[model samples]
Each structure stands twice: as C-alpha cells, then as structure tokens.
Target: MALTATGMGSGLDITNIVKVLVDAEKTPKEAMFNKTEDSIKAKVSAMGTLKSALSTFQDAVKKLQTGDALNQRKISVSSDSFLSATADKTAQAGSYGIKVEQLAVNHKIAGTNVTDPTLPVGEGSLAFDINGESFSVDIAATDSLAAIAKKVNEASDNVGVTATVITSDAGSRLVFSSNKTGEDNQINLTATDTSGTGLTDMFGTGNTTTLQDAKNAVLYIDNQKVTSQTNEVKNAITGVTLNLTDADVAKTTTVKIEQDNDAVKTNVQAFVDAYNSLVTAIDKMSSYDKDKKTAAALQGDSMIRSIESQLRSVASGRITAADGSSIALYDIGIKTDRYGKMSIDDTKLTKALSEEMPNIEALFSTPGQGLANRFYDLADSYVKSRGLIADRETSYTNQQNRLDDQREAFSLKMDQLTARLTKQFNAMDLVVGQLNQQSSGLVDRLNSLPGAVKKS
Candidate 1:
C-alpha cells in the first residue's frame, strides 16, 4: 500500500546495500589515485625548490664568468676639490701626480646694445658658422631686436646655438652662445641687408664683443703635458679619463688605482655561498627520514644524482695559462668537505688574491673552460625552457591529467553500476511482492473453507 516493494523491497534495506557495494568499489581506487597525486605534486614542488636554488647560483656564476667584473679597479684621489678621475680594467695600478694647468670654456659673442629694442634692423638674413657647421636666420624688415633673437633661438636648423636678449640700464643687447669649444670650432657670423646696411648696423659680428673664448683644457700628469677639447681629458693615462674642474698650476692632486680586492672577495664568497645553498636544497630533496618511515619526493632520482655529479666535477676543475699561471679553487683556499660543502682558508685566500689574481681570473672567467662559464652552462641546461626541471614538472602535470581522466571514467562506471543494481533489486522485489500476494490469498481461501475453521 505504501509502495514499499518498490523502495524497501521486503525490508532488506536495499538502498544502503547498493551504497555499500558502490563504496566498496570506489574507496580503494580513490585512495590509490589520491596517493599517486600527492606523490606527483610533492615531486613537482621539490623540483621548484631546486630550480630556485639553481637560479640564484646561476646569478652568482654570471658575475664571475666575465673578467670585467673580477678585474675591476678602485681609485684614490688625494683631493677631489680640484679634479676627479675614473679608470677602467686596462689602467695600470699606480699613483700619478696630477696638475691642473688650464680649464676649457665654451665660445660666446654679443653685438653692441641698441637704444630701442623694438626697432627693426632691416630686410636681410644673418649666416653663422661654428667650426664647419653653418646655419642662417632670416631677418624681416619689421623684426626687432627681441624678434630677431626669438627667430634665431627657434630656428629649426640652428646648430647648437642659443640666442638671448639681456636688457641693462644703458640699453638692450643680443648675445649668441654655443658649445663651439676647442681650437677647431671657430665662431663667426655675418649679416646682409637689402636696405642701406641697417641689419649690419644693429647686429654686426665684425663689431661684436668676444664675451668668451674657445680654449682646450690643459693638464699635466707626472710632469707630462696633455690637452683635450673639453674639460674631460682622456688617454693621458692608458684606460684612464681625467675630469678638470679648476686651473691651478701650483695645486697638485695624486690619483691612485688598485685592484678592488674587497669587492672581488665579496663576489667570490657570494659564489661559494650560492653553491652551498644549492647543495643544501639537493640534500633535502634526496634525504630519507628514518623516524617518519618516509622518503623525500626526489629520493634516489637519477636527475638529482646527475646534477650532484656535475657539481662535483665542476668544483674540482682547474685551468693553466700560458705564462705558467695555473690555478684551481683549491689554490684560492676553497676546500671541499666530505659532505661537499665549500670552506675558505682566510690566510691562503688573501695570499692567493694578492699574488695570483691574474691566474684566478683565468680560472674563473677564461671563455670556454672557466669554472663560472662551465657552471653557468650546466645550470642553464637544467633550468632553462624545456630543460631538465621543466621537463619533469611537465611530465608530472601530464600524469595528473591522466589520473583525472581515469577518475572521471571510474565515476561513470560507478554510476552505471549503481543504476543497474537498483534496477535489478526493484525487479526482484516486484516478483516477490506478487508471489506473497498470491500465497496470502490462497491461505485465506483455505481458512475460509467449511471444515478449515473447525480444524483451527
């Protein structure tokens, strides 16, 4: 009456039975898939950590791969009040007595002042020549002193010249200035007028005052004279550039250049530190924990082994130059312990840097076989695009995708099984219900028979 046959089916708890059967099939497979996923994800994370360490180590290696960074120089100036100096790698390490004999200035010229700055000069043009470069400003018959200055200042083809009007109590004057310095850059200008030479009367270069002269900077290094077009003098010393600020034949400043040892040591230590950090990362990834009864994700992995082997091989490398200059990290006091960590002997390192810097440079920065060079290449192979670590991550991700696909397929199978079991139980329940109905009717009819009650 309550449709229990379709649902409970003679109180057999069919719903729970079907659920238990489905769970029994799903739980183990689900747990296995989850375990596999966890393992793959852990491996991917470990690869990430290793990649990070490798990247940092590569940065330090890049700093040492070039001889420029390692062969840097520091300068000492006795006095910067008068001058300053800069040097490059080719500059020899020594002291030089510098004397600032002269300083250079830009050329400037000004025409005679006019009583009325608003009066037009004439219909004409003015041509200017600085060094070999030439430009011209057309003067209109109605253009005044201020107007002429503006035109010259705004000329599209004007070469490095500035025109300004300075008004004093006596009168207003127009001035022309340019960066026409050095003896080669002579400054000259001329005016042509179509009406009664009025343009030449107001702004003639022949009568203009030489406000400033074009002169070269002169300096002396160790009693040797040097000259330059501008204040910045070059090649007075090989690989050195001197900046002259003020002239004083009597004031002498001393410039000294030497190897930047502290900076070099700092860089070397950075490389060592980065290498040790990467080693630590590798160790963690490959370690097995006895207490936890667990192993690291990358434990016993071939890629890890290959990377460690490469590091050891690179660490033990050596190079020898043509001038009997031979070096290894060992000669620079970098020692390897049993655990493959590097340590420095301070005294030995100091001595090596002081005496064998050239050999050290050759060891770490000499193009193909240097320590930094080889290490950088190795690191690139592991961490670059589609490289070792990236390939592993990609593979792990693909595995995850496949596992998800398998899970989806399993889910569909379980759904089908659940539906089939439900259908079969419902059919069997319908048949049992029909048989019970017939039996009850037969027993009732027997009980109602004429002698059946008397027997009861």
Candidate 2:
C-alpha cells in the first residue's frame, strides 16, 4: 500500500516509463500533421503571384478590339523592322484604298571626321526648328558623331525633338526631326561649325532641304493630312497601320496588318491554365472518402470552401449580348463538372469570341462588375482570409514547450527514485553480513558441546 516502491526486484512495475516513452514517439506524427496544416495555412498566408494586372492587359486588348474611329488616318512605321503589330479587329468592310510610300534618307552635309553619324565632331552640331521650338547643340570638334547622337537622344526634354541618322550610298548625314505631330513638326538644320580642322563641308549644298526629302515623310489618310514628319509618324490615336512602300513625293501603295487572334487566344489559354492550377490544388486537398472516413487536413477549411464557391459563381454568371442574346461563361463553353474540373469547349468559345465578342466581353470583363472580374476579386480576398492552420501551428508550438517541461520533470523524478533505491539495497547488504557472523558463532558453539559429551 506504499505510494511508491523502488529497487532491482521491487514489486512496482516500470511499464509507465515504457508507456510514456511510446507516447512521446507520437510527437513525430503530430509534427507531420502540424506541417501539413502550416502548408494549407500558407496557401492563404502569402499573396499569390498576381495574374499580371489582368485589367491592364485586357484594356490594351480592348483598344485593339475597336478599329480607330477615323475616316482616314496615317501612321508611320518604325525604321527598325524588328517590331510588328496587328489590329485586334479588321477595318469595317469597305473598299479600303491603301497606299505605302518609301523615302530615301537625305544625307546633304556630312561632318568631316564624322564617318559614322553616331560618332561626333568637335565644336560642330546641327540646328533644327521643331514646332516653333528653336534648338542648337554645339558638337565639340573631337566628339565622335556617336557622342553628338547621345546628346540629341537626351534632348527630348528641351527641343521637343529627337534625332536619327539614316545611312545611304552617299554617306551619313545628321537627321534631326520633331518628336511631335501636325504641320509644325519640321526640322531645319544648319551646320553651326563646319569650319574647324575637324569639320568638313559634306553638304555640297547649303544647310537646307525640304523636310519630306529628308527621312521624314508626309502621309495623308483619306485626303486628310494626318501627319507631316521628318521621319515616319506613329499615329497611334488613329489606329491606322501604315506600311510605307516608298517615301517619294506622291508615292501610292497599300499596307495591311490583320487582327491578332493568336495573341488573344494565347492570353485566354494562360488565364485558364492559371485558374485550373489553383482549382486542381484545391480539389486534391479537399478530397474525401466517406467509407474510409479519411479527410485531408484542409478539407473543412472555410477559406477553401469560399474559394470554391466564388469560382463556380463567376463561371456561371450571366451578361447581356449585343444581339439581345443572354450570355454566360457556360454559354460561351466553359464547363465545370461535378468533380470540380474546368474544360473549355474551344469551338463554341471561339465562335462566341469572334462573332459575338461584345457578349463574351460583357460576361467577364466589366471593370469591377462582371462575373469573371468579381471572381478574381473574390479569389484575391479569400486567399487572404485567416484560419485554423495558424491556430494549430500556435497550438503545436505550445504543446511542444509543455512536453519539454514534462520530460524534464519526469527525468528528475526518475533520477531521485534511482538514487533512493540504490541506497536501500546497499543497507540490506550490511544486514546480510551481520546475519552471516551470527550463524558462524552458533555453529562453533554446537560443535564443541558434542565433543565434550562423547568423552563423558
């Protein structure tokens, strides 16, 4: 009935020590569960890499969707042929008369020692008038034309001008032009210092020429002067895609670039893939087996449930169409089945996309109003929601601390008990020694008494 007993053969059992040690092993399992919970929690903890400002990209595409609303428009093509673009929509069906013009770059005066226009010449520079703005830059005699070119490039702030040098069979001549639009955007160049030892009179003619004769070309759209430039003009506002076939005076030609359907399709696919990746992750984590009674750690998380609902809601949302036909993502061929997987009916979607585009746009692209827009917003919000994962992680931390304390206490108790048990066993050893001494004395006395009796 002792509260405790200790020794090598004491009646008390050491099974509690064994049982507790076994229980301690459960920590690893708990740790794994905690880690999984943290992972699930982390799904909401950090903001996802965003879909690259979907609105901005969508707006850019939307602009393409509308052909410029001008009867006649002119656009200048870039000298660098590497860049190319197409309209998002074709011009309204019409007998569109198109023309392309090519201009030979005028290299009137080449600065001496300025082999490449990019290299600069000392105390030598070109002057030009752009939109009534007067500008003069003094190029040092030794400065390579390249150095002078850098200064011109940086003068975007002062002269409202930019300069480019076009190479021709004749040689390189400084080509300075107005960066602005309208009739005022003309360049008048005069050699400021063509007299230095470094300066050479390359312009056999005086410092003057028609701006059109220079690389700049004047373009008229539908008999309207849309642009007059010392170089090609980019009339982005008009949306006119100009292909310059020749820059000579009265040049006649046609330039055409069609709508870029492939780009739009690629963008759509990217969005679908991103969204599906998120869905797939959620589906795997939320899977459950009723018979087995097993559920994933994130199965009942509110955030997960909310995310699923928002996605479905967006996919099912409706919008009005141009032809008064009602439209929805489903109508446009985005299908979501019971298993929470999404697949697009490409044929149906594409037909709706190209033919009834306004309807498709209405379905998912209202700035802050459409279903797709709202759904993305919801996803953004839900991904930030707080919940159980964080709570459990905290609990695990607290439990680990408590376990450490409990183990320490138990170790101290075991040590004390061991010491007491050893002391008790050592005392018993002294008692056994005393008993041996007494027994030996008794044996000797009995042996002596027997011998005396025999002699009698």
Candidate that scores best on TM-score: 1
Which 10 successive residues of model 2 have the least lDDT summed? 66-75
Local error of candidate 2 at residue 202 (angstroms):
9.5
- lDDT of each model, Cα atoms only? 0.86, 0.51
lDDT of 2 by residue, 306-390 (tens): 6678667666767664566677767767777786666778888777656765555555565665655565556444333353334
Model 1, span 199-306: residue lDDT tens: 787667566888888788888899998888888888789888888888998999999999887877887888889999999999999999999989999999999999
What lDDT is obtained when candidate 2 is compared to the true structure?
0.51
lDDT of 2 at 82: 20
Candidate 2 wrong stretches, greater than 4 Å: 1-85, 89-95, 102-129, 133-212, 215-240, 245-276, 289-293, 320-326, 345-351, 382-456
